[model samples]
Target chain A: MQLISAACWSTYRIFVAYILSLAFGIFYGVSANVSPKREKFMIALLDVLQSVPILGFFPVAIAFFAAVFQGQRIGLELAAIFLIFTSQAWNIAFGVYETIKTLPREFGEVSKAFNFGPDFTVRRVYLPAMIPTIVFNSGVSMANGWYFLMASEIISLGNKQVKLPGLGSTMMSYLAQGNIWGVIASIGTIVLINALLQIFIFRPLVRWSELFQYNATGSAPEWPTVVDVLSGLGRALRIDTFLVSLVSLGNRAYGKVAKYVIYGIGTIVAAAVGYLLYWLFTPPYPWDILVQIPTALTVTAMRVIAAVVISVLLALPFVIRSVRNVQTAQNIYSLASILGSIPAVIFYPPIVALGGRSYMELLSILLLLTGSFWYALFNMSKGAMLLPGVLTEMSQVFNIKGWLYYKNVLIPAILPPLITGALTAWGGAWNASIVAEHVQFGDQVYSIPGIGSLLTEATSNTKALVLTVLCMTVLIVLVNMLFWRPWYSRSAEKYNITE
Target chain B: MALLDIKNLNLTFRENGKELTVLENINFSLNEGEFLCLVGPSGSGKSTILRIVSGILNQYTGEVLYKDQPNPQPNPNVSMVFQSFALIPWLTVQENIELVLEARGINPRQRVRTALKYIDMVGLDSFEDAYPRELSGGMKQRVGIARALAVEPEILLMDEPFSALDVLTAADLREQVVNLWQEKKLPLKSVLMVTHNMEEAVFLADRIIVLSARPAHIMGEVSVDLPRPRDSRDKAFEDILDKVYSMILSSRLGK
Candidate 1:
């Protein structure tokens, strides 16, 4: 009966958390993608968010949320939702950004040439392009959310420990009490339910979207009513289609108004820049939290460097191998995708078992680091594969091999992908560290002294503190300035093959 | 006297549960310094013959004898310039040429020197550090030529190298190629090229071998008696071009 109740609560939390995170993710991701200037900043922010684990943010989330609604009883739910939101937001945003940036130019040009305008473009073009990518990210993010669901529900700060009677809280309670059977049963039940949900719900959605892939090859398959519903919405809005038709009608009636179209774009750009600048100056929290920025900035710098070094080490060999041989390269991709989908927590049990979770908790930390490493590897390999076969043949004909080959050809070939992956993985490591630092096995708890552990302690004691919020904001800015800026500038200067 | 010899070459490609023969019982031989043009209708295995002779393709029944010795496999001794100016876009003109030197473990300064010499040789010295994408189509082909030259190959095989260029550029590139061939004839001992343009074939080739339609065999061989630095408008060149063009067109109709 308890298990049944626990299952119900877990389901409810996962569903609510997934939906909220996915929504915020899509909004940020899509917006950043369309606005090229915003993309770097948004992606940097996401990287910092992803790198810091869910448990680490709980303290600040609780503190801020609790202060706003001092007497409110739904603080626990809000905290849970926010944790899921941050966990998924970065990934979803990344998915959106990646999809948008990679969308076929021909498709975009074709839409524009036909005078589809903004409304028709978003409905018929952008949304359709984003669906498959969005779904993939959502599935991956839900898996990420589950890793910390147990930690998120039970708030512990110094003397105040609150269990919200959800599956997460129940699992924590069972684990704390050394209930072996209960932990096993919970993990098993969660996995089974999730697998079933995937097979029944998500897989079919993914398969359905494969029909759209044919459009790129000029042989679009029958898409069913989804496209119709979107087209209908576009028509009802009469925004892009209506405005464009009106413009076309005017062009026929009175010959040309390109200035008005240009003015509309100018206005949109002005509004976006104004909004971004405002956000940059405004602190999400009070002035007191802003004072703690320097320490947080230093910590973030250390973390970003550590993540980059670790992830590159893991990704480099695989990338080189993939570039040298095509068949092995494909296999490497499949391996990365499988590993990428699995949550970082799966490594925790073996890590704690093997390494005792000390500062030299080398194995666990490596595993934690690899959660991001695999992501970098996947993107790097894909980018390397994109190097034109003709270019490769030229390299071979010229006999460019080994270090020179990598330095002159392969490095330049995959630099953009490498930087992008490194940033994304840096974000992933931040999130993974939260779960990695805090390990509970057989009535013994071990934690490393970092933001992850601090967050865990803050949440455990239910101390509504602004520590996490302050740390995250500082980390985001520092990452952009210290890492992404130099990298992005270098990429822009080096790889701009404007044909 | 033969620099390269093909002994009874037969090529087949397997697709969708059936083996399709593209080249059947092909035979040819060429002496040192001779320019050979393998011409036929598209899909008559002209490119396949270059690929096989260059050792790019090995799934065939044939012996490509190099200096009276059968070529075993693809190697650097034979270099091919693809129809698509296969220049590595990321590398600069100098770096692209230096790649072969690097792979061969030549000293960095010496490699740069040699690469620069070749870049200058191809008249791209000013654009030595420019990327392939930044260069014109003709310039990219020059880089391709320089890259092949840097390898110090015994036989130079070109697969419709001028096809992707504009007519004026193609003519200009052809003139530059013949001049280079006259000037530095050591590395490129013999040239075997595939061309759809009959004029290009007639102007460059000593002997133009035409293949029959698919399951391609030697249909005929036309020897170009035109002198060195041959004019495209020369009666002999035009007559050979007309004959080869009709043969290719008639072969297509036959297919």
Candidate 2:
């Protein structure tokens, strides 16, 4: 009964966060793509924010919300939801932005030809076009939410720790008590929830989203027999029809109230920002923490680089095999996704126990690898799938083989996706760094010297925490602007394979 | 003996637990010094035949013989031009041609020389350094032709080479292809092309093999027997076009 309620609480948190993420993603993505001038700023801002690790927001969440609600449970609950929101939102938003940006000009022209009003265009054209991207990203986002579940639910403000009643907190408590059976049970519960979500939600939605794809090739992969049978059962029960009608009814109601809702949200956001800015300016800031940032960032950056390098090396063999065989690609892809959805934090107790204080640094790196490696693996596998049929045929017909094939064809084909994966992996490494560099179990606090540890240490002091997060964000934004942005655009332009 | 022979070719695709027969009993041969066009309606597995012959596809049950031997492997003596002009976007026109040469183990110096020679033949002379994205659709196809010709293959396989181009560009490139084939400036033995356009088939092929719609098989072969610089305005060309059109239409209607 305890496990069931804890699972339900975790599910509730993830569900609410996902809903918020979907709304924010669509609004932000559409607005970014709609205006040319705003696109540059919005995209740039998203890039910076995306690089900021989810844990970086913990301080702000604690200081602002805790103060607003006078340390009430509602405040902490909102903070946890906001933390999960941070993990899930950016990717979905980026997905939406990309889908809107790349939507065939014909769609816009058709809408204009009919003189579609803003509401009509969004309802009939843009939203439907975004469904596939949103659905796919939703799976990734949910996985991320699960990965960060423990950290979000259990917050440390100053000396007092606020623990929410969820699977994450339950597991943490189990680890603290050294209860092996309870830990195993928690892990089992998580896996069950993940599997249920995959079967009931993601699989069906993925099949449904095919209808919204701009040039849907109708070559969707076949689901397993069980999924087919379940979906068939759904159809027989008229569940799909009922859901469609419910969604349509909601859409109609939303359309009528959307203008007022937008205005209301705008005003609230403006007021919050104004108040936050005032609070920010009247501060006794941590000046010493600012000086330590560059050195700490360098240390953290080195670990991130190490993690990304190892991930690429590990992902390469799978990517090469995947490019050669579709079956291998699909199998590896599904297996990796399942493994990736398991939170890296769950292994911390066992890993920490095994490694002990002597091997803490190595263990930290290992944990970082678990968190970040899948981005590289997933993106490279997806890139392999997108290898243009004509290009592959070109290689085969020419008898291009071995090293030569990798150089001229395969490498160039996967470069853009590899870069994209590495960029995300880089961010994931930074996010994982917080939990990795510093770990807490029972009454023991394990520590390492890095930006992650620095941020974790500063959590007791809100001013110091805010300062560390700010400095870290600045460093991340700088790295993205200087290194990743140029690399991404260059490869995307040069290595693009089109049929 | 024919340079390339596809005997009793059949291809079946299994989709969603159902067997879809795309081609059946496709028997054809490419003779030396001949221009043959396999003309059919779209989705008639005409392109699949090109793919099989080129050794990009091999799941089919049949023998594609090169030099009267069962050639399961891609033959070095055979090269293909894609409808989409599948040039590597990153590689310059020169590099694109050289890539295949490099694959064939031609040394660096000879690779450049051969690439340039073909580039000149296709009139893409100074444009060798330009990327595919920089080239016009007609020019991109020229590079495609040049890349195929650079391999100095005895048999050139073109899959709807002009279909993706505008009508005017297609007409212009069609003339160039004919000139290249007729002039015999390269070490060319024969040409096999797959096209859905009946007029394109009549315009290009010395002999046109008409294929029926799906589960496609050779309907009939029409010998052009026409002279060089063949004009579409010519009554002979129209008559051949009309015959090929009726053959395709009659089969489609029959299905």
Candidate 3:
């Protein structure tokens, strides 16, 4: 009964959260693209949102929402759902935005020549163009949600604690009582759910979405898929005709109300922005929180830099191996996806069991590794696969292979994606620190000195929370501007084969 | 009045804040039923002229008049076939043909029938359900032509449509296009095509407009007097090709 209830609650939260993120992502992503003036500002805002750790704001969300709802279960549930939305929303929005930017110039000409209205363009062109990207990132975001869901489920600020009824809480309760079997069962159940989703949902989606794959050319698979069989049956039974009629009716209904609805949404958004600006300027100046920033930042920065360097080194060899063959790349990719679904924090209980005096730092590094290393590996391998046939042919003509191949061809080719992967990896590492820098196993809790844990501790006091957020945002912006910007531009100039 | 007119056309491009003039004082016009070809040295703004006339680009200091009216928006009576085919990959040949009709708010069943008719006309009867990715380059261009024709526009603009296809395929398609126009099955009253191939221009055009190099201007206009299905091997055809080639070659020099 408990297990069923936990599953139900978890499912409910994820369902609501996924819809919210997807809606917000599309709404804001399209809005940003349509209005050219806000494009840069909106893009930058989304970048900051993604980089800001969700768990860092847990205390603020809990405190505010709890007061708003008077400590009701609904308030906690809303908080959990919002946290999940933060995890899933950014990537989807970025994917949508990126797709809009990169659509072929010819697509624009076709739209103009055909004189397609906004509805036709959005439904047939933009939406279809967005499928593979949305699906791929949704997989990534779902994995992201799993990691943060655990932390959000069991929220603690000072002496106050609220534990939502879900697998995360169930696992925590089991861990508190030293039920190793319970942990195993919970993990097993997670693995089972992950596998089932891949089979029923993701695998089919990725395959089905290939209809919208941008100009890929390969012979049709020799074997038929379940979708093929089902579609064939639908055709045979005239079910497709019925479905099309139903859809067109829905499309007509949507078209009728879409304009008024859009205007309504626009007004609300403007008011919200105006209100947020007002709140932002009406600050009491929580100047004291700046004191903790320097110490916590230095430690966290060191950890992130170390983990990123090690992760890149570790993932590089895999990129070479994976790119050598398609089957091998697919296998490696699926493994990463499975591993990604299990948050790095889940490894803490076992790491805590293997006890030592200085194990916390090592454990933090290990946690950081899981959070980051796969991104580089996945990205570089995918990038390597995109190496043009002519470049490879030229390399082969010149007898480029082994370390020489890496030097002459592979490294330069994968440099852009490598940098991109490293950027996201660092972002994930920053988010992971909220749990990595502070670990709880059994009745005992271990804490380390870092910005992640500092923010975690600061959550109890509103003033500290406010200042911590401000200081951290400034630190992140400065690092991005000073460090990553030059590196990105240099690499882009050197390796932009597209031009 | 000419079916289409481009007057005092001048175009410039800004790349990284550097001004580059692409066309200057480009004057041209098309009579009804004329197969007009714009032939110039490579990178001489031939396609740029085509785009301006199509009203796809308006930044140039010029006027493009369609039926003697200044075309502010893209003229619905005109249609274009792009050099790259521009067929959306996810859409099938049938769907691509129907896309324009759908934009015009045609019924679904009528769209299917109309699209199939054009597909047959393009000799792509069996390939209607195939995606653009599934089609060969030559077949893709044929689809491009069919899509343009599907709109039933009065003016058709083709931008180096055959330049990406094989020579034999291009020649075959050129003949078929001429046949389509000669048979009066195509509703288009005028065709304006851009190409660098001298033989292609001489082979198909009623009048070839020769253009100079960068900041392209009208160097000359050569009228082809050859009979129907003008054989490329014939002395008259070779003379025309020679004349156009010399005009383009001299334009490339300090002429």
Every model's Cα RMSD, please?
21.3, 20.1, 4.6
TM-score of chain A of each: 0.67, 0.85, 0.84
Expressed as tens digits, the lDDT of each residue in A350-425 for candidate 1 is: 4585567554356545655755776687668756655566667888899988889878887887888788778767
How well does each candidate superpose onto the true structure, as a TM-score?
Answer: 0.50, 0.61, 0.90
Counting only residues 3 or more apart in sequence or on different chains, how many pairs clash (N, Cα, C under 3 Å) in candidate 2?
A: 0
Worst 10 residues of 1 chain B by lDDT: B83-92
Leading candidate by lDDT: 2
Instruction: Encode model 2's per-residue lDDT on B1-255: one tens digit a residue.
Output: 588888999999999999999999989888999999999989999988887777667699978888898874567777888887766544579987886776666799999899999899889899988767667889989998988888788889898999999999999999988888888877888999999888888888889999998889889888998887889899989998888888888888888
lDDT of 2 by residue, A405-441 (tens): 9888898889988987888888898889887887766
- Listed models, DockQ each: 0.01, 0.01, 0.56
Q: Is candidate 1 or candidate 3 better by TM-score?
A: 3
Residue A84 accuracy (lDDT) in model 1: 65
- Give the best candidate by DockQ: 3
Worst 10 residues of 3 chain A by lDDT: A242-251
Q: Model 2: residues >4 Å from true position, as ranges?
A: A110-121, A204-288, A324-330, B1-255
Could you give the candidate ranking by TM-score, starting with the highest?
3, 2, 1
Ordered from best to worst lDDT, the candidate numbers read 2, 3, 1
| Candidate with best TM-score | 3
